[model samples]
Target: MNFDYKLFEMINQFAGQNQILDQTVMLFSKFGPILFGLVFVWLWFSKSGKKVDNRKIVLYAITITVFALGVNKVIELMYFRPRPFVTYAVNLLSDKTSTDPSFPSNHSAGAFAMAWALFWHRKRIGSVLLIMAFFMALSRIYIGVHYPFDVTAGAIIALIVTAVLISQRRLLDPLYQNILQAFRKSKGQKYYRNM
Candidate 1:
């Protein structure tokens, strides 16, 4: 009945007929996180002592993503909307059932947060990551998992939170540095200590 659900159904209908597109969206929806994670690792380890502090950038990106996802969980609890598949007989291409709330998609939030964080460090990589994030968000809808508003709200939330966090680096850097030092002391996975 709502415009959001109407749009969700419209978008989801496109995939029901195209098996290949559905499969592609499903695969992207499933593996997008890993793909972004690998890219983050690549960005961190492939630094050639350039002007940018790759390690710090990577650390901040991770921090922003975690924080955004936490915020998403709180939002989910405050405003619970069932998944589209639950209310309608949608051609659910994804394996995810209608168990989680629909509004404020976590996938979109995490993806955009990382993309924005990456953008803060390097424009080219960040732009590409943002495109990937957009596709990831679209894939969720195509696979009949999230509504348009859910993805939109998630992206908006991530963008705002990530921008604020990055802008307040003076406040956040100390916390990140303290954590890094503590982790380093544990002799865990060793990484660049220049942060």
Candidate 2:
């Protein structure tokens, strides 16, 4: 706990000194997940003649993120870890005031899940997203919203879940294929194809 507090203080100390960097991090931390998710959706549904394997990767990533979030919720319910702002006098940059449990950060979980998913298929884009995800998690800590351990645990969970999903393709392939078949039969097929 002391180490977590010291690290949080060290990171949060940088928030108030630079206005531009602070604002940039704030915006990215607040909306980076959405942007990444939208990018994945666009890649999944875009009619760019990309292989279906890529789309499958996106789907698996999305599924893993959603599942990991659900697991986070369950863990939150079981153990209530208060946010940094609630527990300590820290430099808070963002205006977010939530009483949610801070043991496992949803933002970090989702970001890392997407990062791992994308990295599994598209190396370059995935690497960029992975860096972005790491910064996003750091921003959460820097903004005094989460502890280092919370984000670290979230990241570990995301990686474990992603690895499991990627490795167990035999069980997942048929299920995903059925979902894709249903999607193809739907009316939105005109907007996206080849999967």
Candidate 3:
């Protein structure tokens, strides 16, 4: 508990230091989730060899992220933790404020879900996403909207969710296949038939 505050202090200490650095981190924290979705879209349309498998992987990752986010919402309802800025005297960067509970960050949970999901299949892409996800999670702390434990808990939740979903791949396989087949037959997706 004490260590959580110390770790958060170490990270949030950087806030209000420099405009350029703060701006960069703020941008990452804001758009990191959107970037993850865009990456999946890009992967779906890429000329990569394993088109079918890539699409399936994208679906799996998306499902995991969505599932983790749902879990976060439920957890927030049961256990509410105030934002750091709301509780302490800290350097708050962004002007935004949230009524939502701070424990188990939704941003970190969803981002890490995508990162860990992709990491299992595409190491290079997954590694890059994972790194970006970490920085994004750290940025949340720097902005003083979340404690370090919030992001850490979020990441742990993502790990557990990813593990559970991956283990149930068999249940997901036929669903992915059927969805892909239906999508392939849709208008403007004729080329997907060969994929």
lDDT of 2: 0.87
The better candidate by lDDT, 1 or 3, is: 3
lDDT of 3 by residue, 1-195 (tens): 689888999989989999999999888888878998999999898878689989988998989998999999999989988888788898888778886799999999998999999998999999999998898789999999999899988998998999999999999988999898888777556645456
- Give me candidate 1's TM-score against the actual structure: 0.88
Residue 123 error, candidate 2, Å: 2.1
Q: Count the backbone clashes (under 3 Å) in each candidate.
A: 0, 0, 0
TM-score of each predicted structure versus truth = 0.88, 0.91, 0.95
> By lDDT, highest first, what's the ranking?
3, 2, 1
Candidate 3 backbone overlaps, count: 0
- Tell how far residue 31 is off in model 1, in angstroms: 0.6
Model 1 bad stretches (over 4 Å): 49-52, 177-195
Q: How would you encode candidate 2's per-residue C-alpha lDDT over 20-104 as one tens digit per residue?
A: 9889989999989888888788888777656466678788888999988988999999999999999878888878689889999
List lDDT for all candidates, in order: 0.85, 0.87, 0.89
